[model samples]
Each structure stands twice: as structure tokens, then as C-alpha cells.
Target: MKIVELSMVLKIIPKVLQIFLNFCLVLLSLILSFLLIKELTMFLKIFMTDGSSDYKMFIANILIFFLYFEFITMIVKYFKEEYHFPLRYFIYIGITAMIRLIIVEHDHPIDTLIYSLVILILIIGYFIMNITPLERPNRQK
Candidate 1:
């Protein structure tokens, strides 16, 4: 009887953890949505108030906004695709992040070149993923 009960508890553990993780993800999505909105508002405010004098800041904020948007979309895709995140979305995020890093922190020429290389690698990976056939391990054919 004790062994049977232990087996049941072990089975329940994964379900509980899955539920907890889903709840956390939902909360994160809400937070990111709010942040995305805030970034939009900030971008607009900067545009209207200061004109294009702060072009660097303006561009940086735009990148941040897109980053938030991509994360939210990735989370939504996660729930839609049966909790499986596609590799392409991650590669897209990586490329965007590297570009943003290059734009925002170009003080060092070597660092910017390295970030460009990273972006190039991510793009190549994305192309490779696209060319490969989709393999859904958990799908029932």
C-alpha cells in the first residue's frame, strides 16, 4: 500500500509542477504585455517631446519594445503549440538581441564585430532550421 501511494504521489508531482509553471508563464505574459505598452508610450513621448535629438535612445527603446513583443509572442506560441517552443522563435530572439546589443553598445569596435558575427550565426541556424523538415516528437501521427 505504501509503495502504491508513493507511485501515485510521484505521478502527481509532474502535473503539479506543470500547473505551477503554466501559472508563472501566464503571469510573465501579463507583465511583459504591460511593459510593451509602457515602452510604446515612452517611445511616443520621446518622439513628441524631444524630436529626433535622441535618436540613439529612440532606436534603443524601439529595440526593447520589439524584444518584449517577441517574448510575449513566444510565450503565446508555447501555449498554442502544446507547450513546445519552436527553435525558430528562439533564433529570431537571439538575432534581434544581438542586433540591439550592437546598436546600443558600439563603443568597442571589436565587440560590435563579435555581436555581428553572433547575429550572422543565428541567421544561419534559422535558415538551417527552416530547410529541415518539421519533427514533432510528441505528436501522434
Candidate 2:
């Protein structure tokens, strides 16, 4: 009957979507790996260059390198943890990004203050998350 066929199609859709998502994630990991390599080379180049190199630019690039590294690590963690992303990695990324933003765009005092506050909030949140138990007793079987 058409109902049976429709039910079969519905069941297949989720599997197909999961496969597509996995493929996209793999492709993204590859791209991020290339970008991390490029960032490393650029960092080395900036480090080796003469005094003409901008210090702010150098710091910014280093932050960017770490950012790429963190993302790649997160992706690896994703596969290792059965496709689930831990909130800690996201917090780490947010903290790193906020620091990078502060360093690269401190031209405005107010904006810099706001960014600093945001970083503080993230750190506090991370601290709270750290202290919490991984599993609740009620959730346990």
C-alpha cells in the first residue's frame, strides 16, 4: 500500500540526512586542517620577518592560529564522543574568540570594556559548569 511506502520513505529520510551531515562535517574538518596549516606557515613567516612586522598583526595572527586549532580539536572531539559536542569546547572557543576580539579591536574603550565583561561572564559560566556533576541521580537508570 502507499502507506507502507510512505512509512519506508520517512524512515530512510533521517538516515540519508545523517549521512549528508556526516559528509559535510568531514569536508569541513579537511578545510579547517588546511587553514590551520596555512596559519602556522603565516605565523612562522611573521616571526622570521624583520622589525617591519606589526606586533599587533603578529599577535592577532597567533590568536587566529589557536582559534583554528581549537576548532579542529572540537571537530575531533565530536567524532570521538559519538557525534555529540560538549558544551565545554564551545565555551573555550567563545573565550578564545573574545580575547582575540579584544586584542585586535581595542580602539574603543567602551567596546573593549564590554568585550572584557563578556569574557568574564564566559569564564564564570565555565567555572560553574566545571563544578556541576556530569550526571544527575534522577537521570540514572
Candidate 3:
């Protein structure tokens, strides 16, 4: 009886921890989203005030916003998929981040080439993940 009780307690512990972690994740996501919005507003205000014609800065800011958007989506997906993170979202984030890096700092040819290669690898991984089939457990007869 003691062993059974201990086992039950152990199982309950994990569930409790998972719930707590999920709550924290939600709170963090909300905070990050608010921060992103504030940054975006600041960017827009700067652009409006300066009346500058620098398309690069505008594009970079847009890409950064997409990164934040993807992160939030990833968090939402974690809850929707029972705490499992889908690989595609991570790949998407990686690709976006690399592109942003290239756009913001592509002065060196070798560095640009390496970043491009990284983006290529991430694209290949995304393709493979999409093509792979998920295995379902077989029902016992």
C-alpha cells in the first residue's frame, strides 16, 4: 500500500509541475508580446518623426516583428499540441532570424555566404520535417 501511494504521489508531482510550467509559459509569452508591441510602436514613431527613406531599417524592423510573432505562435502551439513543440515553428524562427541577420549585417562576403548556407540547411530540415510521416501507436487486438 505504501508503494502504491508513493507511485501515485510521484505521478501527481509531475502533473503539478507541468501545470505550473505551462502557467509560467503563458505569462512569459504575454510579457514578451507586450514588449514586442512596445518596440514596434517605438520603431514606427521613429520612422514617422524622421521621415527617412531607409527601406533597409524598415524591412529589418518588420522581420524582427515577425520573429516575435513566430515565438508567440510557438508558445500557443505548445499548449495546443499537449506541450510538444512542433519542429516547423523552430525552423521558421531560425530562418527568419538568419535573414534578419543577413539584412542587418552583411558587409562581409564570407559571413553572408555562411549565413546563406545556414538558411539553406534550415530550409532542407523544414522540408524533411514536412515530408516525414508521424507514427501512431498500433491498437492491440
Candidate 4:
């Protein structure tokens, strides 16, 4: 084989290994995240005998579910070669985190409103940055 092909083969060996590891991580993250949601449900069922706090428990469970979904989405993106470190995912996580904060701090109306708006602005900026197509490829020049 040409040296170039041999070198490419050598380079690809590590990448294939990484793909296996990436798949394991994705599976693990999905399993663990769902397990957390399940565990939270079990906890709610056991502790909610006192129905006075039912609304609080419901909100808490929903927040847990949302956070788990965000984490699984991030892990799936890690398998991408071009976006192994996805800043957009981080922004998404941040926005979700802010929403969680708002839900938890609803009593503080001003702070809750501020954080909600911040999350809105951040999501808008994320779309603006990511949705625009890349500059033309060299062949188009």
C-alpha cells in the first residue's frame, strides 16, 4: 500500500476505537439519565402521601426530566467529528438551567422574569449564529 494509505489506516484505527467509546458513552448517558428520572418518580410516589406539596413535587420532577433530556442530547452530539465539543449544546444547557432556576425561584418575580428573558435572548442568538450557512467552499470561488 502507498504510504499515504497506510498512514490513513493507522490514523483511522484510533478513530474507530473512539467511535466504540463514544457509543458506549452515549448509551451510558442515556441509561443513567433515564434512571434518574425513574428514581425521581419513585421518590415522588413515596413522599407525596402529603398532598399539600403536590405542585412542588410535580415541578421538581418535570425539571429533572428536562435536565436529563438535555444531557442525553449533549452526549449524542459528542459522536460528531466536526462538533466533538459543541458550544451550542452548552448554550442550550445554560438556557434550560436558567428556566429551571426561574421555576424554582418563582417567588422572586423580578429575578425570575430577568432570567427568563435572558434565556430567550440566548436562544435567539444561538439560532442566529448556527443557522446562517457557512461561507462558500473553495470550489465556488
How much does each candidate deviate from the true structure in C-alpha RMSD? 2.3, 2.2, 2.3, 4.9
Q: What is the C-alpha local distance difference test score of each model?
A: 0.91, 0.90, 0.91, 0.78
lDDT of 1: 0.91
Worst 10 residues of 1 by lDDT: 50-59
Query: TM-score per candidate, in order?
Result: 0.91, 0.90, 0.88, 0.59
Tens digits of per-residue lDDT, candidate 1, 82-135, equal: 988878888888988898898889999999999999998898888888898777
RMSD of 3: 2.3
TM-score of 4: 0.59
Model 2 ranges with Cα > 4 A deviation: 136-141
For candidate 1, report its TM-score: 0.91
lDDT per residue (tens digit) for residues 46-110 in model 3: 68876688778888888988998999999999999999998889999999999999999989999
In terms of TM-score, which candidate is stronger, 1 or 4?
1
Tell me the tens digit of each residue's lDDT in model 4 across 20-126. Answer: 88778878897968777796776668576665566665676677677777777777777655538677878877887887787777888899889989998999989
Per-residue lDDT over 1-141 for candidate 2, one digit per residue giving the tens place of the 0 to 100 score: 999999999999999998898899889989999998998898888888888559888888888988888888888898899888989899988999999999999999999999999999999999999999889668565
Best by TM-score: 1
List pairs with backbone clashes in candidate 3.
none
